[model samples]
Target: MSDVLVIGAGPAGLHAASRALDAGAEVTVLDAHDLVGGQFWRHLPDDRAAADEAQLHHGWKSFQQLRVRLEEHPRCRVLTGTEVWAIEPEEHGAAARVHALSGPSGALRREEVLLTPERLVLATGAHDRVLPFPGWDLPGVFSAGAAQALAKAERVAVGERVLVAGAGPFLLATAASLIATGATVVGVHEAAGPSALCRGWLSRPWELASSARKLTELAAYVTGHLRHRIPYVAGSAVIAAEGNGRVESVRVTRLDRDWRPVARTERDIAVDAVAVSHGFTPRLELAIAAGCAITADRFVAVDARQATTVPGVYAAGELTGIGGMALSAVEGAIAGLEAAGGVIPRQLLAERARQRAFAIRLERAHGIRPGWTDWLCDDTTICRCEDVPFGALSLTEGATQSLRAAKLSTRAGLGSCQGRTCGRTVEEILRQSPGLLGTTTTDQRPIAAPVRLGEFARE
Candidate 1:
């Protein structure tokens, strides 16, 4: 087994591996993607790469540095296309036993490797969270994350004309990516009203100055919007999408302070495609598998050194919280140093503190509101894979008292995706209903990662 085994190859994972190597440890990194860059640093292939590949991303140079250093290090082994299917929790603060498959999933043969590292760092990152609407299951309706991925990695526009709507700053980034891919963005509708934005942003003035670069990035986005002549509408949202086969148009509506739709402010906009994201939900399967303590807010709980409650295990990036890339990199550095048994620098801790305060501001500014569910109609689909509608969920299935009972009776989270697409939304919908007994948080999956049945036979 290696001294350190880091899961994920995103901004946090890449930096963790590099810092661990620098601390004189032989490190092994496992990433599911064929490329090292996680979702944030996703890019085109070398042959199809942009002349200035760095321009497409915000923190491109730093990602390049960390990736190159790790790849070129003698004590480092970077395994792309390696999916960690399970992490067997250990007692007495021992490293967790990690079971993974090394190769493409559809390959003729795949190798299964199990390792118990001396120190394990998990940076599994987060995924786009979408609120369900009437026509969300349609083909042209895409998550903002998937739309941005297609634009950045494939340089392909999702549609000729598009509309971006969501709560967080990520909508701006998604819109920019779409424009870069030559898509005509008609408008961006932010669900959070001006008061919510001010509470999250304008309340803290001096603290924001510490995050000048973040402001600069936001400015760049605004500048791009002005250049593209895309309208930025605040205090509004796309409450419903309507189309024949795929999404052909969306109904936009003005929202109250709590995101409830105003009665007479409904209007429609015609667009070929729509990208929506409420925010991000952390990927917690690996962290939970490692027996880490999760916070009430659903992020992995970590200490000052970025060490989890469980000894020999550390977590960074979005797993710890939904900060941007800069905060993720800082967290990664701290976790690496602590995991490698190296001392953390005072400056590093200071930077992390600064970044974290800004992360809090972002959360306040863009956190989801309870009234979002008011936008849903009876026919709205909650679990898309199983075709479970909001009305269906409201109907009493045999003794559906709790979240588990609802899942068992209605089969909402038991679809092909195993609740990845609709887990959080379903949980919230059931929790809001007074008919449900005890509202549970998101469901945990034991075999979270996908593995070929053939690989299981080989095992």
Candidate 2:
């Protein structure tokens, strides 16, 4: 039996496994992808074998270095293209029982029983959160992250004319990348206005000099928009997308202080594609399945140790909460230290707390304002997966609410990309309604992708 089994090979899981191996524990790391680095740095074998190392995505370098270190450790085992379906307490005196599919099928499956290590760290990362509107289900519409992935990983463009929409730092980043890659950016839309900058400046003092450095990136990104002549439309959002088979045009509107759309202020812009996203939500499937306690907002809650309520289980990185890559690496290191039974220094934890406090303030400062969805007419689609309109889902006794209550509501979650694209819109809609906060959680599944029955039959 292995001494430690990390469920992900992302930064958090990699750090945890390294720490455990350093502490003389036998470790095995598993991931659903064929390579490490999770979403931030997804690479295929071709990417790994690329002749131009400098052309490799910056994010993958860290994962590549970690992969080399782990591979050289005789005590560690790395399993790629593996899915852990369930984790349960051991029946015998063993520490825990992990059930996983070795490949695509049940044929080569194994019940990995590990002598529950002193700790288990989960660094599953985060997923894009999108808000739905009219014609969102069209082919050319994708989350901003997906657009980046398509270009960076798959070397494919979703379309030639792309308009990036939504708020937060990611919107700017996506726009920059698309513009750099030869896409004709019609415009960039953000929900927040100049006031967001004022709030950011106020919290900059609290985070000290570090906050200033980060804000510089946002400023640079905005400046890039101006230099590119890509109109940065603030205090606005995409209200509707119109297209035949794919997105060809969209309605953008400026919102009032209360977030209501001004009448006759809507402007239409034609674009072959749209990359829209709000922000990210923590990816907590592994944590939740391992019985970790989730917070009020569905984020996996952990104390300073990065240990979850479940004994021997820990979470780090965006799984705990979304910050950037630096925060994730620091959180992972702290979790690793604690998991290895080592004491984390007070100064280190203090730094994390300080940065985290500032991060919370930043999130609130730029968070989706109240009544933002008032821009959506009753006819606008709320659940793009099922083509369920806002009014149909919002009515007091609507079938929408009924499906949600019965947990039979795939309308919001069952799209081509599953719930990754529209889960937040559903949550926001529900949160707007009274008494609906704790109704459900993201569906916990063993494997996130479809497993072919033939692969399951493989030995």
Q: TM-score for each prediction?
A: 0.97, 0.85
Global lDDT of model 1 = 0.87
Clashing residue pairs in candidate 2 (N, C-alpha, C atoms within 3 angstroms): 105-455, 105-456, 106-456
| Candidate with maximal TM-score | 1
- Kindly give the stretch of ten consecutive residues in candidate 2 with the minimal lDDT sum: 106-115
The sequence of per-residue lDDT tens digits that candidate 2 reaches over residues 1-459 is: 337667777777887777777666777788877777777665446534645432434445666778898988998888877776556655354335665565544443443323344356677788787777777778889999988777655656677989888777777777776775678888888777667745754645756466554566567777888898888777788888998888889899887655667788998889999999877888766676677789886788899788888777778888877776656766777877776666677876776776576567657645767667776677776666566677765764643453355134436565644555556666667667765634665446445545455544552
- How many pairs collide in each candidate, listed in order? 0, 3
Q: Which stretches of candidate 2 lie over 4 Å from their true place?
A: 44-61, 89-96, 104-118, 206-208, 211-227, 396-421, 434-438, 442-459
Candidate of highest lDDT: 1
Compose the digit string of candidate 1's lDDT tens values, residues 216-317. Answer: 989999999999999998888898888899999999999888788899998999999999998999999888877888998899999999899888999999
> For model 1, what is the error of residue 116's alpha carbon versus the real structure, in angstroms, after optimal superposition?
1.4
How big is the RMSD of model 1?
A: 1.6
